[model samples]
Target: MAAEIRTFTCLTDNFGYLIHDPATKATASVDAPEAGPIIRALEREGWTLTDILITHHHGDHVGGVAELKQRYGCRVVAPHDKSTKIANVDLRVVNADVIKVGSLLARVVETPGHTLDHVSYVFDAEKVVFAADTLFSIGCGRVFEGNYPMMWDSLLKLRALPDDFRLYCGHEYTASNVKFALTVEPDNPALKARAEEVARLRAENKPTVPTLLGDEKKANVFLRADEPSVAARLHMKGADPAQIFGELRERKNKS
Candidate 1:
């Protein structure tokens, strides 16, 4: 059976994920944004957290790690880079590493851009990816520690995943991402439709996540830098995809 995932809001806009394997009754939290909510969620589900996975060392992502580890005695798994600065990591993982969560498996994919040590976990059997801050529903993370080319490459790595794969990102930024994406491809019908859908979801206080990769390919301007329509809209028909992606990132930063 596939792992069951539960998502809850953490902090201001961050999201915390709890993934449980029913067969083995093992559970894991993707990031520890806050301890109170995550502890409450685990208690509500009657699941004991066996592992805590860290994508990067950002404070919001690891703020509650120590507390959660103390409370649940969970193993901490994080990136292998020395620069990450995360504490109490029992296991250090790099690109292509496979992590075992009971009977389920999560393959790590290095997705640097948001941070040089950023990594995403792909559960092939479940067709789901916990992308953290690297790839959001309609927008990618800012190039805070890496360059535009690095960010573009990271997005492409995610874009190359199976179209049926569902993406679970770190934040609830879809509504704003939709608005910014429109400035790059205003005439894109798919984007326009997605904007409407996002608006409706937000109005109802619903999550707009676990979105299909196929939908993102159609509507996310950041991932469509190579598309003719996007290129034409940016007036860079023959420009390299990375260059177009850089310009779009810059525009989004200003927006």
Candidate 2:
């Protein structure tokens, strides 16, 4: 049977995910944003936490790791690169590493950009990706630790994934991200439709997590940096994809 994944809110805007494999009764928390919410979710689901898969070392991301580890005694799986400290790690993984959660297998994808040690977990068997910080529903993480080119390259790695993959990103910034995308490609029908849809979703105070990669490619401006039309929109025809991405990210930062 396929892995059962749950998404819930954490902190102010961050998201929390729990991936459970029923066959072996193995459950893994994608990240420990906060111990309270995670504990509540576990109690609600009646699933015991067996592992914690960390994507990055940001405060919000790892804030509850220690508490959760103490409370549940769950194994903590973190990235190999330790530019930032993440305590209580049982396994340190790198790109191409395969992590097993029960019968479920997740391929570690090193997508450093928002942070040099950042990583994404791809559950290829389930066609789902937990892209914390590095990628978002309608946007991407800011280039805080890596250069523009490095960030762009990291994004490319995600973009290379199959379009059918379901992307479970870090935060709930789709509303603002979609608004910013309109200014970049105002005439894009897909983007325009997405903006309207996002507006309705937000108006109802709904979560827009688990967006499809295919739809994101068609609507997300940042993902289209390599598209000639996107470059032309900024009067930057023939510019390198990395340069276009940098310009788009800069504009988004200011927006």
**Residues 30-122, model 2: lDDT tens digits:** 989999999999999999999999999998999999999999899999999766789899999999999999999999999988999999999
| Cα-based TM-score, every candidate | 0.98, 0.98
Write one digit per residue (lDDT tens) for candidate 1, span 1-255: 778999999999999999999999999999899899999999999999999999998999999999999988899999999777787789999999999999989999999989999999999999999999999999989889999899999999999999999999999999999999988888889899999999999999999998999999999999999988888888999999999999999998899
Error of 1 at 195 (Å): 0.9
What RMSD, rounded to one decimal, does every model reach?
A: 0.8, 0.8
For residue 137, model 2's alpha carbon misses the true position, in angstroms, by 1.3
Error of 2 at 10 (Å): 0.5
**Candidate 1 residue runs with Cα over 4 Å from true position:** none
Q: Show the lowest summed lDDT stretch of 10 residues, model 2.
A: 80-89
Estimate candidate 2's alpha-carbon lDDT, on a 0 to 1 scale.
0.92
Question: In model 1, where is the ten-residue run with the lowest total lDDT?
Answer: 80-89
Backbone clash numbers for all candidates listed = 0, 0
